[model samples]
Target: MAKTQVEYAVEGIVTRQMIEIGKKEGIDPQWVQKRVSEGRIVVPLNINRPCSVVGIGMGLTTKINASIGTSTDIADIDAEVEKAIAAEEAGADTLMELSVGGDLNKIRKEVLAAVSLPVGNVPLYQAFCEAKQKYGDPNKLDQEMLFDLIERQCEDGMSFMAIHCGINLYTIERLEKQGYRYGGLVSKGGASMVAWMKKN
Candidate 1:
């Protein structure tokens, strides 16, 4: 339990927690051990996270993630917090704070403090919004601004980040050649970048 997957596999000892959980689920303990030994399954137990449940991935029961947050037009932190609580009570495996409006830091911290489950976010949305407000040109957004926002989110205890790293300069060219469809890049980050590209 105190080591990586490779380290645990080398030991060849079935962890008691795995065995107990498998027994409760009516699964073979050895099968659980084998799956854990492989890298296919990840038990994301952050040292700071207080949740006791162990999540099983890859062929496990389907899980749902509920996204709750404030939009630029509807920047209500209290409402967003309430929505997050409601989502948790409604059985969401995880919550994502997709708040692009209001005090982003305050909203994220409030949600994290209110929930025991994992929290995720997309740092680029906050970055793009802030950049546009400060510089009047979204494309003028600096890499440092994005990195600082990510670091701030991590410091505020975000368990995961949805970064669009693959959509870089070259990818834009490819997308341009592909041309626009009805929706035209539904990704918020992609759309924001395209808007900035058009404006600049």
Candidate 2:
């Protein structure tokens, strides 16, 4: 495994990507490195993808993440690529491909080629999507499938991902303890986790 951005920062190395990000954000490299090392900011850069890195979270200018991709019904690869460019032109700081249709690898390459911002993906979506295709149900998704998808995406140059591990039995206990019922939570990723846990 490679050292994370935080680890590199902690070792007092302001990576080239960090320097570029600092220059664009009008921040000094040392300040960016310090924040990255402290976990106050996160710069997701996959060694497989060569693009300008940027930071998110506290003490930085608000960054926009535009999610644009193809669906089963609307898998227009060209349109998706165009949308990626438009999002960057409109000042989106990041691009996440939630593509669940067509040739995903080709679409990813096209989108990455079309945009310069940091790129992210939800590997679980692909994992479950493939699982459903193979087993006729997403409920058949397993840990091996999930981890394989993650490794593949990382190798394919995904800068970041929204791993669905935050909600667990402990979270349920805490919610019950707090009597917290924030219903109608609109998180597709969270819902997927809950559904997977329920079935598994």
Candidate 3:
């Protein structure tokens, strides 16, 4: 297991990524390390992928994370890679591959290779998409499969992930208790999760 930035910071050590980000932010590397140790800053650089280092959190510049994805109707890896490169060229601080179609792993790899920006993703999208394709229903998603997908995505060098840790049974119960919700949920992953919860 590798030591995280926070762990290294706690030990009074500054990582090269911290120094690079510090230079970009015009702050001292020690200050960046201190903030990281204090949980006030995040440098989303995955060990498996070497790309530009970006800092997000308090006192840092606001980062624009551009999302590039493919739906079932239009799953084009080449186009998604172009979008990833375009986002980077357009000064995006970070990029997220949210493709739910085609070979997701291949698409992610191509997108990651397309630019120097740190890349992220929503693991649930792949998990749900795979489940739906395999079983003809997203509701048939297996718990183990979801966990495995998360691990695989991490291994694939996703610097960040949009994991829905807040939408659990307790939240669902409160949602049902409230009743008459306006504007319903707009997130596909969220909607599928709620449906799965209701069924199970």
What are the per-residue Cα lDDT tens digits for candidate 2 across 1-200? Answer: 77888899999999887888788888898999998888898997877777767889777889899999888898899999999999999988899999998888788888988877889988877887888888999879989988987888878788889887878977765665787476843677677777787777
- Highest TM-score: give the candidate number: 3
Q: lDDT per model, in order?
A: 0.73, 0.84, 0.88
Worst 10 residues of 1 by lDDT: 44-53
lDDT of 1 at 42: 46
Q: Model 2, stretches more than 4 Å misplaced?
A: 173-182
User: Tens digit of lDDT per residue, candidate 3, span 85-200?
Assistant: 88998999999888988999899888887898989888888998888889999789899999999888888888888887669999888888999889877787788788988887
Q: Pick the candidate with the highest lDDT.
A: 3
Q: Which stretches of candidate 1 lie over 4 Å from their true place?
A: 1-39, 42-56, 193-200
Model 1, span 1-200: residue lDDT tens: 34643356446766665666467557776666677777655444333444434445655565678898898799988898898889889888778889988988888888888887678888888998889899986678887998988878776777677887666666778878888767878898767766665555
Q: lDDT of candidate 1 vs native? A: 0.73
Please report, as a residue range, the 10-residue window in candidate 3 with the lowest summed lDDT: 183-192
- The deviation in Å at residue 83 for candidate 2 is 0.7
Q: Check candidate 1 and list the clashing pairs.
A: none
Which of the two, 1 or 2, has more lDDT?
Answer: 2
